[model samples]
Target: MMTPDEMMTLVTENALEYGPKLIAAIAIWIIGSWVIKLLVSGLNKVMDKGKVDPSLKPFLCSISGIVLKVMLGITVLGMLSIEMTSFVALLAAAGLAVGMALSGTLQNFAGGVMILLFKPFKVGDFIDAQGYMGTIKEIQIFNTILKTADNKTIIIPNGGLSTGSMVNFSTESTRRVDWTIGVAYGDDLDKARAVIKQLCDADERIFKDPAVVIVVSALADSSVNFAVRAWVKAPDYWGVFFDMNENVYKTFSKEGLNIPFPQMDVHLHK
Candidate 1:
C-alpha cells in the first residue's frame, strides 16, 4: 500500500519505540525471578526459626512463592509499558468467576489452614467425628485421612471437620469405662459387690487413686442393675472392658451368683 522506503521508515520507527522496552522486560523477568527465589528462601528460614508446624511450612512457602511470582509478572508487564488497567480488570473478573465456581473448594482450603494452625488433632490420634471413628493418618490441604481399626482408609474433607464436633479419645491419658452389671433380685448384695470389687482390683490397668465406683443403679423387674465404673489408662480401655465382662460372667457362675433374665408367665383358659 506504500512505497518501499516509506514502509521501511515506519517499521524502523516502530522498532525504535518498542525494542528497548522489550529487552528491559526480559531482563526484569530474569532478575525478578532470582529475587523471588531468594525471598522465598529467606521466608522458609524464618518459618523454621519460628518453629512452625512441619506440615504447614511447605504450604506457606508455596503460597508465598505464587504470590511473589504473580507480583513479578505485574512488574514485568509494567516494564513493557503494556496498559495494566484493563489487564488487571480482566484478571479480577476472571478471578471472581473462578472463585465463585470453587467456593466449596476454597472453604476446604481455609478449613485446612485453621486445623493446621489450631491443631485439634494430630496424626495417629484416635478420633470420633463426622459419624466415623478412626485414627488420623494424615492432614492434607483439603482432606484429612484416617485409618480404621480394620485397616480401611477414610478420607474426610476439612471443611466440615474443622467446624464440626469431634471427640478425641487420645487427648486424655485416662478414660472411664462404664458397665451395667445385673444380678438376680434375691442375690447377696455384699457378695456381689465384693466379687465385682475383686475383679476390678485384679486388673492392673484400673486406676487406684480415683478408686472404683459400684452402686445399685436400678431395680428392674428382672434384676438389680449395678452401675460399675472404673478408671483406666486410655490405651487399656477396650481391653479392660471386654476382659472384665468375661471375668465377671465366669466368676458369677462359679460363685453361684444368679444373673437374672426377663421371664413372664402366660396363661390360657379354655
Candidate 2:
C-alpha cells in the first residue's frame, strides 16, 4: 500500500481529470434535450405550413426526434471521454442487419412516402386497384385502409399501391352511363329513340347539353339492339341506370314494342 500522501495525490489528480467533464456532460444533456424539443416543434410547424400530408407528419417528427436524441447522447459520451469508435461500428452493423431483415417493409415505407408526397388519391375517394374496389378510408405508413361498398374493410400494402395501376372513379364529377336496349326485329326505331330520350329527360341528374345518344348498335338473332348512353353526375349514375331499365320494361309493352329472346328450332323427322 502507498503512504497517505501518495493516496491523497492520486485522488486529487483523478478528480481534476474527471470533475469538469461530468459537470459539462450533465449541462450538455439538459441543453440538448431542450434543443431537441424546439427542433421537433419547429418541424411540425414547417410541415403544417408546407401542407405536408397529415398522416406523414407524425412519422417524420418521431424519426427526427429519435435521430436528434441519439446525436445528443453521442455528444455527451464524447464529452466524458468515452471511446465511441467500437460502439459506432457495432451500431452500424446492427443497422445493416435490421435493414436486410426488413427490406420489404422499407420498400413499403418508401412507397408510402411517395404516395403521401404525390397524392394520386385522397381519403374518401372511390378507387379501383389491384382488382379491389373501395373508398379510401385511411392512408398509413405501410398500408392503406379501404372501406368497401358492402361495409367490408380492406388493407392493402403501400408498395403495390404506389407502383400499380389505379382507377379513381371520384376524380370526375360526371360519368357516362351506357346500356343496350333490345326490341324485336321491325320495331319502331324512332319510337325507341324517343322513349330513351324521355327516360333521360325525366331524370334531372342527366345532362341536357351533351344530349342523350341512342343508335342502332347491332342486329342480334332475335332483336335489334339500341345503344343508349347518357351523361349524368357521378353520384347519380347507378340510380339513373336502374330507373331507366325499369321504365323501359314498363313502357315498352304499353307502347306496343316487343322485347325479344333468342329461339333455336331443331327439326329431326323420319
Candidate 3:
C-alpha cells in the first residue's frame, strides 16, 4: 500500500538481519559434514583394530554415517529457523510406529550383534540347535544358514538361536566316541574284550592318553553288551566310529563270535 521506498527499505532490513545467519549456516553445514566424515573414518579404524566381525562392519559403518548426516541435517534446519520441535515429535511418532512394526526384526538384529560379539560359533562349525543339526554356512544379521549332513540347507532365526541352547561340536579339539557291542550270551567275554582292545590300540586316529575303555556294560535279554569308549580328534570322530564298527563285525565273525538277535521260542500244544 506504501511507496517503492518502503518495499526497498524492508527488503534491505531483512537482508541485513538474515544474510549473515544464512552464510553462517552454510559454513556450519560444510564444516559439520567434513567433521562427520573424519569422525566416521576414525570410528571405522577403531572398529577394525577391535576386530569387529566382517559381516557387521559394513552395517555399523553405514548406520553411523546415516546418523551423523541426519544430525547434521537437523542442525542445518535449526539454523534456518525452521521449527524443529514439531519435526522432532513427528520423527519420534514415526519411529515408534516403525519400531513396533519391526520389533521382531530388530530383536533378530540385536541377537546377531550379540552373537558376533560373543562368538558362540563360526562359519564352517558344526552345531546343533533348535532341533536342527548342521554345519554353519553363514551367520547373517537375521538368520543363520546351515548345511545339513544330508545336503539340506536350513535357515534359522538368530533371535531363537541366541536364546536357545547350542552345541558347537567343533569348539573342542578332541571328542570321545562311545559304542555298545552286543554278543551272544555264551560268547567268550574275555576274548571279545581282548580283540576290541587290540583293534582300538591299532587305530592311529584314536588317542591313547585317555586310554580306551572296553568293559562288560550290561547283560540284556538276548546278549551281553560291551561298552567301548575311545578318544579321537574332533575331525576323526565319525571316521573312527564307522571304522570301529566295521572292525568289530569283521573280527567277531572271524573269531567265531555270535552277535545275538531277538528270538522267540514258541511251542504250540495241541
TM-score of every prediction relative to native? 0.79, 0.77, 0.85
TM accuracy, model 1: 0.79
lDDT of 3 at 119: 89
Q: Candidate 2: global Cα-lDDT?
A: 0.92
Worst 10 residues of 2 by lDDT: 192-201
Error of 3 at 171 (Å): 1.8
Q: lDDT for every model?
A: 0.93, 0.92, 0.93
User: Which pairs of residues collide in candidate 1?
Assistant: none
How many clashing pairs per prediction, in order? 0, 0, 0
Kindly list the per-residue Cα lDDT of model 3 for residues 113-193, writing each as its tens digit. Answer: 888878899999999999999999999999999999999999998999999999999999999999999999888889999
- Lowest-sum lDDT 10-residue window in model 3: 52-61
Q: Pick the candidate with the highest TM-score.
A: 3
Segments in model 1 whose C-alpha atoms lie over 4 Å from true places: 1-39, 49-51, 72-82, 267-270
Q: Report clash pairs, candidate 3.
A: none
Residue-by-residue lDDT tens digits, candidate 1, 47-67: 788776688889899999999
**Which has the higher TM-score value, candidate number 1 or candidate number 3?**
3
lDDT of 2 by residue, 86-181 (tens): 998999999999999999999899989988988899999999998899999999889999999999999999999999999999999999999999
Clashing pairs in model 2, backbone N/Cα/C closer than 3 A: none
